[model samples]
Target chain A: MTLSLPNLGLGIGWRAQLAHAILNRPDIGFVEILAEDYFLSETIPPPLQALHDRGVHIIPHGVGLNLGGAEPIDPARLAALGELAQRMQAPFVSEHIAFVRAAGLETGHLLPIPRTHAMLDILVKNIRQAEAALPVPLVLENIAILFDWPNAEMDEAAFLNAICERTDALLLLDLENIYANARNLGGDPVALLDRLPLERVAYVHVAGGYEADGVFHDTHAHPLHEEVVALVEALYARMAVPGVMLERDDRFPDDAELGTELDAIAAAIARGNIERHERGFAHPVLSDAS
Target chain B: MMSASREAISDTQADLVRALVHGTPVPAGFDEQRVQAVARSLVNKRRQALARIWPSLVKRVGDSFIAKFTEYGQTHPLPTSANALADGRAFLAWLAVKEPPTDDLRIEALAYDLRWRETPLGLCRRGGFGIKIARLAQSEKWLLGLRTPWRGDRWWGMPANV
Candidate 1:
């Protein structure tokens, strides 16, 4: 399957606390909303509607789909997500490759599934189910895991590739997660990037985190580390990244700080484009900018 | 290649979740330290979420809030409905049992109860008419909470002398 995704440009996660700040920024090309936030509301929130009115692409991102759970996908949640996408006129919706619940319990956190072939089969089935139910194309994201399951059939890259390959789901590669996993689990972030199907990456998520007790935590509450910014540079240097956005979940700073962080990301992307250009690689989307 | 069946994967995933939230033994072959770290992180995340939902409760509990909520989280997994307000109400209920609810805390709890009703699924907005009252902890003062279908909520705090 081929994906002709648009270049979303630089964006930020649409949060209520940051709504005013985000709207004030004229450079934002897109915004991602937590799908569940509007499940009960009859109409889109005014700020979001305003963003939509201004022609900013709003993407509905689901956090509770449990797409990798052993249980079957929740029909109601899938329908709600589809309805939300249709309401928002989203180009494509996104969900994690991890599960948030299993059995009769809810973890309230995204948990990793074993990367075995059997597990991969389950993921593919779930993704296929979601793809059939959603209004638009589905994009899956790799979560930051604290630990790997006991035995795994494939590495992260191969497992992610298989899921995308089987389901034709686009990728929302999160650079902070890659950095955290590499720091905690021992792997080369750039090497993993090389093995990944960058062409499938519909967008990218860049966030901040901190290390404690010798382990890096993807808290999304801190400032963007220089190392994560460098990963952004490395990724953009490799492909014509369609979209890249910042996700700040907690400890939000002032508007100036957020704008500064975005500028840094833009700078990194430009640097990557320069590198790609110098290497004689031509990308139609980034040609004029590079 | 050893292929895991759906049922097997289901059980394994259940076991892993149980360990993370219920403080069960770490699944074999997984790093115990890493599992513990994840478990801690989950607990902290839930606590932070609860604090956000119940700011008054957190402020009242002060430094003891973390320890109290952490204890409540060990045995009680998050509400299946995934409603932050429901989780906060559950925590408040548990807290009330351990310690007498202060007037402020009681008022806060009553305020939420006025607007939302706890259900098996989660917290749902009360649609019909309902009345709630609470006696002040330190005085003879009484608080009246009235919920209506259309007008939202109305509260009256009795005079201190009354």
Candidate 2:
């Protein structure tokens, strides 16, 4: 079962570098705000408020909630995310299937979790905990894996299905990640795309990356290659996803350079046959500012 | 039964992250070459991230920055918290001390700390302290973002900024 969210047509990952740019751009429909990037506050940040005023949807995308860890989810972190979602008036929120930390140790980057039945149990338990705390639906995103676990009982598709089935959570399918993993690990990205649950996807993420030593790290700071763009087109043909956005982290380019990528993403959607340019939000939903 | 499986997950997860960031051995049945490649790439990511927070350090350290930064990471666990900017700050403070006590190093630390503030968001410019710190420090022949910190300290065992 999928909870319906606002289809903020073509959006960009909320970034400070492009903050002013987003305000003036009409084609931009939504912004996926990095949940951890903001300071913990009871009130909305100025930039997001500015976008909200202009009729743009903001989704709180989190990176640190390690849901796949063997331990129970942190109540405080879950609370923080709930507050962030309420503050943004976002329809849904997202965290990774990967773990950011293990027990007491922190990797400071998304680390791969073993794909096992035991792993699925912990994920379902933590996901349910988060779903209970948050006022909105929590969508779990699949991360780019650099390495694999020895004891994998299933492939990425089956494992993802297991978690979504058990918890009834939505998926934020990142096409760039699918392409990257396939390119690095040797598989057909298209085949992986064909098998996954597209109906559960609330939105899609198309980002660029830097390649070194024949491995493409989903850096998002670089430009999307032609092959990955084709994968986006393929995903569009197969599934009519509601939203697709561009994500960039650092080494931010000039306005024109970034805008071109956003445009490319929008065009990719058309080629994929997702032609609905309409937005779901009728009026701006405002929470108490003070 | 559940508890035993949980322990297995916990131990393996820890071992994997340790292998990636700490240069430990890869777990069995995993591709060793791919795991090693990932470890190096992760270290590179760490270096690039640190470079953004501590740009002058990267510039100052020149070619040896990667080796020095890798050495540092081997000893210190980079915090996985969202406050990577703050953790980067702590690393800079640590870098300042280990930097052989030079004028440029001191100036970098002093100027960096004075000019930036850890706010609710991230490291932001301290209000009213932007170019003034750089200007004042520059007037003392300590070039901000221009000169390397460890260039001339070896001759005197210390060349104070003043």
Score candidate 1 by lDDT: 0.86
Q: Every model's Cα RMSD, please? A: 2.7, 7.9
| Ten contiguous residues minimizing lDDT sum, candidate 1 chain A | A281-290
Candidate 2 Cα deviation (angstroms), residue A134: 1.4
Model 2 chain A poorest 10 in a row by lDDT = A281-290
The sequence of per-residue lDDT tens digits that candidate 1 reaches over residues B96-125 is 999887887787788888887654334566
Off by over 4 Å in 1: A282-290, B1-4, B117-128, B159-162
- Tell how far residue B7 is off in model 1, in angstroms: 1.6
Question: What's the DockQ for every one of the candidates?
Answer: 0.61, 0.37
| Candidate 2 runs further than 4 Å off | A274-290, B53-64, B80-82, B100-162
Q: What is the C-alpha lDDT of each candidate?
A: 0.86, 0.73
The lowest-lDDT stretch of 10 consecutive residues in candidate 2 chain B is B151-160
Q: Tell me the lDDT of model 1 at A134.
A: 88
